[model samples]
Every structure is written in structure tokens, then in C-alpha cells.
Target: MIHAQTLVDAHLYPNQEAVMADALRALLHDKPQLRIELAIHRYQTEDLSLAQAAHIAGVSFDRMKALLLARNIQLRLGPADADEARKEIAEMERIIARRELP
Candidate 1:
């Protein structure tokens, strides 16, 4: 934190606010989401359900399902979901290879 006198000195300058904002952005950027997540989990010590965890993370249910699948946790069990997983994998691969690229 800055000294109170420094803030008082910069009271009349718009650029001082911008400088503080840039510094804050730089500070946050240094930590990755995984680091932040682990720290939060360790401190809060709450074993939230996957859906609840996703909501806390500010992501949609579908995105959280994808994240679980990435971590090899099943969203559902049995044959139909296997077919759906194959389809999703194929679609993701196609999209990754072609849809968003030249």
C-alpha cells in the first residue's frame, strides 16, 4: 500500500489513477488461475459439488462439465454418454483444426 501522503499528492492527477490500475493489473497477472484456485481451496476447505464449484468459479454448467471431462471425471455413466463423448471429441478436434484458423 502506498503512503497516505503519496495519494494526497496525486489527488489532482488523472494519470495517477491509471498508474495504480496498471500496477494492480500487473500484480494479478503474475498469478495463474490454478495457483489461485489451489490457494482458495486450501484456505476455504469446502468440498463443494462440481456444479456448485463451477458456479463459484463464474462459469456455466456446460463449461464446468467440460472442465470435469478434461480432468477425466465422468459427467454421466453408460453407453449413450460414450457416444456423446466421441461426438464431442470429434467436434472439438474439427473446430480446433479448422473453424477458427486460416
Candidate 2:
């Protein structure tokens, strides 16, 4: 991969940060399909929220949902395991008991 410093030194960008940002932006611009695929992967892998993935792909929430549906990927927003649900419920119960005390 071409380094950001190389691009900066070549005068393609004013600074290292700008070069890196512009390179990434250009890559996404050039490969719109890749952006969508990456966003869906991030959402599916739980690396980003649906909204975040949509933003990253420069699309709307509905568009992101459509993409996911097209790929037959399930929408998972909450915990997948019973243990996590129990922990959440326990926290909620503690909060409720505290509120009832005062």
C-alpha cells in the first residue's frame, strides 16, 4: 500500500493526515459497492451500529436495511445470549429497587 507520507511528499495532498483522509474518501467514492459491502459487514459483525454503518456508506437507514435484506443478513441489535439478557434484567431491577426506596 502507498503510504500517506509518500502522497504528501508527492504534493498530492498538503499534509499526511489530509492525504490519508483524501485517499480513503477517494477509495469509497471510486467503489460505491465496496462501501455498501463494508458497511453491511461492519453492522453484521457488530463492529458498528446500523445508523453508523449507514452513515459510513453515505446511505439512509432504509437503504442500509435493504442492503442487509438483499444479503439475507439478520438484524441483530441486542444481546444474543440469555446470560446477557439476565444481566440487563438484573441491572434494571436494581435501578427499580433504588427508585422505590426514595
Candidate 3:
């Protein structure tokens, strides 16, 4: 369980307190789909990993992957570094060379 307090300045609204209370109630109880959609959006934007988003959505990794695919959301493992790509290429070349020799 996490405890959080948000300070909102709704002075312009006539019934600020009531509006805020209703909004909070809707967010907490009537909007589970909204939470899942936000989690998926975060994953799509690379703000969260698939695992993190899955945890947020209370789903498995495979389920998250399927959801992303269903939504046409591309899964980014992480940013690819040039050095890492070069190292991977070199390793593959070495493996291929050894196979050719045998």
C-alpha cells in the first residue's frame, strides 16, 4: 500500500472539494481500464519497460507483449549502443569463422 497526497489548486471551481472527491473516487474504483491504458502508454513511450508496465497492469510479460502487439505498439528492449552492436557483430563473425574452419 502506498500513501500519497496531491495538492490541487481548484480555487476557480465553485465546488472544488466535491469535484476533487468525485474524481478521486472515479480514479480509485471506476477506472481500472484507465490505469491499464496509462501503463500501456507508458510502455509504448519507453517511460517503462515491458516488465514494469506488466507489473503495473497486473499482467504477465507474455500478456503484456501480446497487448502491445495488439495495439500496434512497438516494444523497445532498450536503446542500442553502437559499441554493443559492434561487439555483437564481432562475436558473430568469430563464431562463423570457427564453423567454416571445421
Candidate 4:
């Protein structure tokens, strides 16, 4: 194992190195596949890139994109856009529900 100082001396971004290793470790662990949609959503809202978010969530980039697509979530849209979409859907649902209420 390399010493922290030595790693630092190599002029690497500490957190980046740590997180990357963590992501790889987690992705390789024996376990059920994680829900990539939820992970991507959270990471997007928290300021992570698609690749970075995938790593942060410990999934492959391809897997993350596939999950987003399967869930009908657009990867190009920001979280704020997603929130607006959610609100619009909620309003539409409420209107529909009220129409049936007599």
C-alpha cells in the first residue's frame, strides 16, 4: 500500500483517487445489481457528471445510462428540469383526479 504522503506527493487529487478506487471496489463486490436510476438521479442533483456520478454510485457509465433510459428519465436534463416535470405531472394528475370526483 502506498503511503498517503506518497500518493499526495504524486500530485494526485486525493478525493478523486479515493472515490475512483471505492467505485471500482463497490462495483466489483458480489451483490445484487443496484437500481441505477435512483443513483443517477441523486448524483445529478448533487453536481456530479454522468461518468463521475456512475462512479460515485459504483456502477458503470453504460449501466447508468441504460437505467435512466429504461426509467424514462432524460440524461440531458438537469435536476431542476426533472423537478419541474414532476410538478407538472403532479398537477396534471390532480386535475384528472378532481375531474372524476364530481
In terms of TM-score, the best-performing candidate is 2
lDDT of 1: 0.53
- Misplaced by over 4 Å in model 3 are 1-30, 78-102
Candidate topping lDDT = 2
- Which ranges of candidate 1 are over 4 A from the true structure? 1-45, 74-102
For model 1, give the RMSD to the true fold: 10.7
For 20-91, candidate 4 gives per-residue lDDT tens digits of: 675566664644355354466676575544555565455677877787787776675433577766664675
Task: Give me the displacement of residue 101 in model 1, in angstroms.
Answer: 40
How many residue pairs clash (N, CA or C atoms closer than 3 angstroms) in each of the candidate models, in the order given? 0, 0, 0, 0
Candidate 2 on 58-95: residue-level lDDT in tens? 78878987888888888755555898666656755765
Q: Please list the C-alpha lDDT of all candidates, in the order they appear.
A: 0.53, 0.76, 0.67, 0.60
Deviating ranges (above 4 Å) for candidate 4:
1-38, 77-102
Better of 1 and 2 by lDDT: 2
Candidate 1 lDDT by residue in tens digits, 1-102: 675346647674356666677665566466546534543353245433443444444455576667667666545432256776666566547645764686
1-102, model 3: which lDDT tens digit per residue? 312223334344345576577667678456767767878978877556666676666667798889889988888664378775665566557655765994
Off by over 4 Å in 2: 1-6, 10-18, 77-102
Q: What 10-residue stretch in candidate 2 is worst by lDDT?
A: 87-96
- Sort order, TM-score high to low: 2, 3, 4, 1
Model 1 steric clash pairs: none
